[model samples]
Target: MSDQLNTRQARRQAQKKKQNSNNKGKSKKQLIKKIAIATAIAIAVAIIATGITVFAIISNAPELDEEQLMLTQGALMYDQNDEFVSQLESSERRMNVSISDVPSVVQDAFIAVEDIRFRDHFGIDIRRLFGAVAANITDGFGAEGASTITQQLVKNLFLENDKLMSRKIQEQYLAIKLEQQYSKDQILEMYLNQIYLGSGVYGIELASQRYFNKTVEELSLADAALLAGIPRRPSFYDPTVNPEAAESRRNLVLSLMVQHGKITEEEAAEAEAISIEEQLDVTEREAYAYEAFYNLVLNELEEIDGITSSDIYNSGLKVYTTLDTDAQEHVETVLQTSEYIQNYPDNEDFQAAITLLDTETGQIKAVGSGREDSGQQRGFNYATEAKRQIGSTAKPLLDYGPAIEYLQWSTGHMITDEPHSYSDGTEINNFDGTFQGRMSMRRALAASRNVPAVKALQEVGTDRAKEFGEQLGMSIDTMHESYGLGAIPLSTKDLAGAYAAFGNNGTYTQPYSVRKVEFPDGRVLEFEPESQMAMSDYTAYMVTDMLKTAVTDGTGGTANISGLPMAGKTGTTNFDRDTREQYNIPANAAPDIWFAGYTTKYTAAVWTGFNQHSENNYFPSQDSSRQIAQQIFKAVVEEVSSTIETPDFTMPNSVVRVGVERSTGYYQVILRQVVRLFMNYLYVVMSRLEYQKNLSTLNLLAI
Candidate 1:
């Protein structure tokens, strides 16, 4: 009975072990099934999120404007007379050509190198896109791009050049949309017209004309291949700039053509044999007639609040400028042609710049950037850009103007012109190295004496002088006694604007070139310069009177025009001893010479010197070179005044002319002497009465 019971217990124990193992296997299978279901749900959610984000981005893309895809027009500039002057040089110089006119070989060359499977694929090449994506994933984003010709066209037209993912999506979406709307031939034509080739040229037609001086239909296979290679890197592969690089690129394009079966190997070899230089006949575009004034307009456009240089170049805007064409032409002629000026310098290195402004409006009417047109577009503009030291011209503007405005000093206020030194013990000397003592303020300013100007600045205070200069639009960076003798540097534009205040009865109007800009969509941007009272009318008159005397009898005598009611100041800057020794310059040589003058109708500032102050370039002590600025100023004033009716400078009612004795430098010495004699006689009579009264008192005491 014990053996049978033991067998039953063992059987039950084995059955229980088998049941536990089966239950563990079932639990493992159930866990695997639940994980698979959760993974599928997560992937579906990710797909939905990506789809929604892409859809939002595509919806927010810029609306397609078919008209903008057409050939772009350059901005136009009109003069103050509302007359057409010239077309501004835009970023793209494209002349559209029909697809039928484009040679088949030319089209094949572009397609061979740019996009090999252009015709076989949709707007996006899926294989190339995937390869680029894989490359980017491995080497970080923005490492590669798979842009089709259609993609490039849309980006050039509508999108900013940025490496953002969103921008790329918008570009691709717009490209696909464009392909759907237009035929293949139309898209090809547009792409050819839109690509920037080189040398400020756009489109194959213009590129052909610019490089080969021929029509698009006349391009040889080598010529077409060379042009096709330039779009890869315009500046780097430009034939005129880098001929060897351009030739290498052209050969690569030919090889690409042969590889794609667009041309026979023998034909490709023949085309590659021809050097890029031989196939090229470069033709330069003629510079605009009003290039200097146009350059000023471009600079002004850049400073406007919302406008950019791209807008000026790409947008079909109309710029209305304050350029008086007649005055501009005259000024240019005077600067270029020596016959128009008197005592003109004969040195080739000698350069002169002049700026003319309407005194009442502060509008820049004419600007001569140099002695001649540099012919380089947007070259260094000396008139508005170059800054040089202004000499004695500062005396009237910095020293005396502030004195009269703040100190109320009469024109005959006495100031001794003697040898003096600054607070730092720097000795000041007159230009002639001699002092004329006890001179009136008017005479001292007319003579441009160094001592009196320093004295006047000391009396008014340097801080106040700088403040007064700032009010008149003069940039005074340092407060020093030498500023009274015109030690500060200023551009011709700056000087002209400052002097205009004197001519405009103390009102300062900020100088500007552009009047208004009219956009393509009927939006107009008007530029109204800031105007403020720079000084009282009395101060303006006092300074103008002194400067008038300066033109008539002082350093600016040569700049005086015969019939024009003008006031002006002359300035000359010298080299230090060290500079003279280093360059072996003459003792009397001047690095810069200026003649700044103005009429009631206009203000003109002329500067003449070498752009560089080397031994080979400097103004000698001869009258012609030293006084070139005056001659230019005189010529410009004579020519510009003839076109406009200029009235004399009107004296303000608040300013009164007072007579002073020339010898004593005071009001009527004769009257002062007579009053002194009468007072002495009255004192003698009173003394005699006092003595008699004293004698009477003594007699009464004795009684």
Candidate 2:
């Protein structure tokens, strides 16, 4: 009985041990499940944190305000009245042109060449991205840009100038947001206006106008296609300098358009049949075109707020300025086309410019920078930039005008025309250096006699000349000090304003380009020289009177207006005059001759020459400057004199008297006070005939 009981207990013990081993295996499996659940939770938390950071970055990208956007676009110049001038930058073809108003063909042409699926993609095209990546990896950078219209807009509006991955990231994020906020059409319009095509073209309309001289509406299928080809490589396909290459490129664009179904193969063939123009194949950009007035407004705008150049274009501020539109156009047309019959084709060297201003309001009416394709931005704006040696032109304000206004010097006041050494050792006279035995200020000025002017300056003192110029708004104390005899540099613009004091009855109206600057919202920030005055009324009248005698009988005789009371001066810079003679060639070249004159209707300044020197050995010297400048001035004046009524130039009292006697600083006569007034009719009216003095004393006094 005892042995049976022990076997039963042992079997039961074995069963219990097997049960414990199974439980251990199950517990281990349960532990592994808990660990996996914890791992997945940790990964989920990390992913959420990462997404939030990325979202924050996407939410806070840099962007441009309306004004800033427009500035980046670069379109701000306007007429005095705030009318549109030219669009400098931007892509929407946004030129105050509405999307619906634009021709469908233009729209299609751009879409075809740029991003085909632009209409469907929500700012980003995965397909294009992949293609761009493939191209970047296989080909080279810039070979393909995956920037959709919206992406490009974002890049232009929000991104910096650097092309980097950081900028690309920002662009992608902003592009998606832009697509959500703006319509495809709005984005497309902005894109067209903002992309830079070439030749300073900014918008589709301007691009059309520049490349075809035709309106966007007027652009043919072929023309539209050719223009579309420009955006990819503007400098490369520039039709102006490279034609055959541009043609090939344009044909490729056509092929792309056909492949993309934007145009039919038949249409592409027709476009291919179209001939490509080798030069300014579109329309020519007119030179100057009121550049002076435009610059004036620009400067003032820079100081003000709201009315930026881009705002001016899109906002269309009513810039009611002082410019006389007709006068501006007249001056510009005359200078550009009808004035000079010749020009230096493309100056491989040198540059030139011109500007004309309004005498009454100091408004710039016209300006020129030669040919549009000169690849120069009015570099050496002769009107304001060039510090050239102005010959007789400077003498008027420095020597003659000051003498009469400040020194009690009369136009009839006589001075010897014979050459003499100055304290500095410089000797000057007329161009020929021929001493007129005896003459009046009238004769001397009419002939541009240098010795008489130098003597007059000597009598007036160089300091006095400096003082006079400073009074007239010339920023030249140093120049004034060196005003000995055309030693100081002067610009056409400054000189014109100085002479204008006479036209304006002595009030020097400071010349300005911009009329007024208005914020984009139509609030004006600056109106240049609202109270600008360059000289006093008395001084202005005095100077104008002297200039009258100059144009009427002086060296500016070539500038006389038949039925008008006109006054002006001739400026011949010291360049190569005649290489054959010793000191024969003057200081500047001849092509820089000038005729700054004014009538009741228009005050114009003319400068002529091949703006650039040719590589073919033709140096555009002073001779070219004189013959062209004077003739152009004459032609322009003659045209106006025939049609426009002449206005009255304020007549100042007294006149320029010459030949009194420089030998003794007095007239050669019985009484020391008896001045042998050459051209004695000047003022023929100052009744103060003077005091008792011996002839010896008077001759000594006059000289």
Candidate 3:
């Protein structure tokens, strides 16, 4: 009976234990399931937060201009016909792209260079990020770029290019968002368009046009590779200057295309046959007047208000400028001609400038700020800025007009040729001490006589000289000085215009750079020169008469031309404080030689000197300035003379011939001697008659 009871109890106990064990097992399973559910819910919330953050990130990017326009700079040049002559370019080129149409090979090459594993990963590649971070930690700078192509586009197009890691983090995050929202092709297209391809090519189309001068569709594999190669180092690999480097980079692109199987080995080999010329035929660096054009453009850019340089440099703009390509070429040719540059050996050390302007309207016909073959560095530009001393050229503009109009000094008025003391006791004299005791004022000027000029200026007064120059458009500051003997700091440009008063019939025409400027949108800015009458027509004629003599009979004789009315003057400054440089008697060669002259149609001035204001100590001992200056003027006049009709010279309407002495300033016409060979017979006959008459009268008196 105990065994049965024990067995029954054992069976009951076993059942109870089995129920408890199963309950325990069920509780364990429930706990495990709950933990799994909690983890999945947390993961889902995190994903929701990430999606919202990415959505917000993509919305805050740098917006792009709908119309892709490049920034351009240009200048205005008006021709005699008042037509636009030329336009110059001053900016980089940017290209546009099609998101889906981008060639896969080019896209893959970008990936290889910018970001590896681009296809398999999101915009932010953690593996690359970790490696970059580690390297940055050790290297102290983020030398390695962890940015994917999409991240780069985000930074370049939208986000500011900050060096901070925070910005980089934002870039990475935004890139990931961009990857999810836009297709791989779309990102690539944006990147190619945003990337800087140098040589003034911006968008893909322009790049194709600028480099290959063809359409994008026409690009071969090698050509495509070459285009891809420029962005990495545009200046360093510039094909114009460094073709080898550009070629090397191009080959690298070809190898990568071949390695990626985007192009076959055979295609890569054929690329060699295509040659660098086939890829990019011309380089913008080799463009005409590239430096001067850009320089002028940069200067003009300062006029606009509230525009960033980037907007000016990058925005694709169509600029209509005054630069004439043909004129620019000619100006360059004239500047580099043997006549202009060959004279300056070791020209790199010296600098000079020349400018040409129209007389009717003061539009700049041509301008050369420096030598043409001066390599890359344009030396000192004397055209607009260099203040050289104007020697005798300013005399006609100052002394002669005032002497004629105010002092009523006639051309034939006699003046002593001896030395005279000034207020400071400084003695001045004629070219030689042996002065013509008396001579006509016209002859003195024709001879470039110093004493007669001084006497006339003394009569006109120092203030009058200054006033006359001011009338002729010369700054009074330059006009007021004791150096009226020849000292005046002036530029070649101002000198030319001041002398143009003669060409304009004693009316000064101010120099003009922009004859007209028209915007691409048809807005025009035009300028017309106003003629400022500086002297009376009669006084002008008087001065021109003397100046004509200067060219015809004075030191300016070298510049004389018959059959055309020409007037000019020669000037020399003292190489020493005591001697003149232009008309210097101390040195055989004049320091600064100028022949400022005018015909009916043109007023031209030429000045030749060393680049620096070398000390007056070194006498200009070679080349009479008259020779070269007149040669240049003569050549220019001859070249352009036939284009214009000869101008008529109207003589002075009235002449005030005062009763000044012929031999002296006093009223005296002293006759000296007259001899005749047959006078002996007449004298004999008269003596015989006089004697007979006296005898007859004496006999009549005696009777």
Full-model lDDT for every candidate: 0.80, 0.60, 0.59
**What TM-score would candidate 3 get against the native?**
0.52
For model 3, how does the per-residue alpha-carbon lDDT over 1-703 read when each residue is reduced to its tens digit?
A: 9999999999999999999999999999999999999999999999998777665654554344223321234333334455544333333344455756566666766676567677778888789988988988888656676888777666654454446655676787677777877777666776676565544344565666666667666666776777777765554454543567878888888787777667788988988666665556542334433345434433344334322222333432233333444444554555557653344444343434555555555545545565645432232345654567777776676666687777665555567777676557777755444577676666777777776677777778888888887776667664443446667777766877877776666677776554444443345445555777887666776677778878887878877876778888877765654544443345443456666777767666666555544333222444443366666566555545655686765654343222222222332111112112322111000112223433343221100
Cα RMSD for predicted model 2: 15.8
Highest-scoring model, lDDT: 1
Candidate whose TM-score is highest:
1
Task: For each candidate in turn, give its C-alpha RMSD to the true structure in angstroms.
Answer: 13.6, 15.8, 23.2
Worst 10-residue stretch by lDDT in candidate 1? 680-689
Model 3, position 446: C-alpha lDDT score:
74
How do all the candidates rank in terms of lDDT, highest first?
1, 2, 3
TM-score of 1: 0.64
For residues 1-703, could you state the per-residue lDDT of candidate 1 as single tens digits?
A: 8999999999998998888888988988889888888888888889999889888988888877887887466669999988888885544377889999999989998998888877866678788899999989999887899888888778767765567888889989998888899888898998888776766567899899999999999999999999999877665687865788999999999999998899999999999889876898877675577887886787677566555333455556799999999999988889988676656655666788999999999999999988653322223468987788899888888899988888877676789999899878999888878999997787898888889999999999999999999998886677788877877988899999999999999999988989988876577889879899999887887788878889888888889898778999999888989999999988877889998999998999989887666786777775567777998898888987887788888877666543343333333212323534543211000112223433343222100
lDDT preference between candidates 2 and 3, better one = 2
Q: Write the per-residue lDDT of candidate 2 for residues 1-703, one digit (tens) a residue.
A: 8898998998888888888888988998899989989989988988998777667766667754555444444445666566665443344333545677677777887787778899999989999999988998888665678988788666655554344555666788888877877889888877776665655455677777777777777778777777778766554565754567778878887888888777889988988987685323455554334554554444344334333233433334445455556655665565555344364334433333455566677776665434343444332244554556566677777887667655655445667777676667855546664778666665666677778877777777777777777767777746442364455666667766766666776666677765554443345545566534444444455556667777776667766767778777776654443442433432432434556777655566655434433223233443343455555566656664676566675443322222344333344323313443443312311102211222234433322
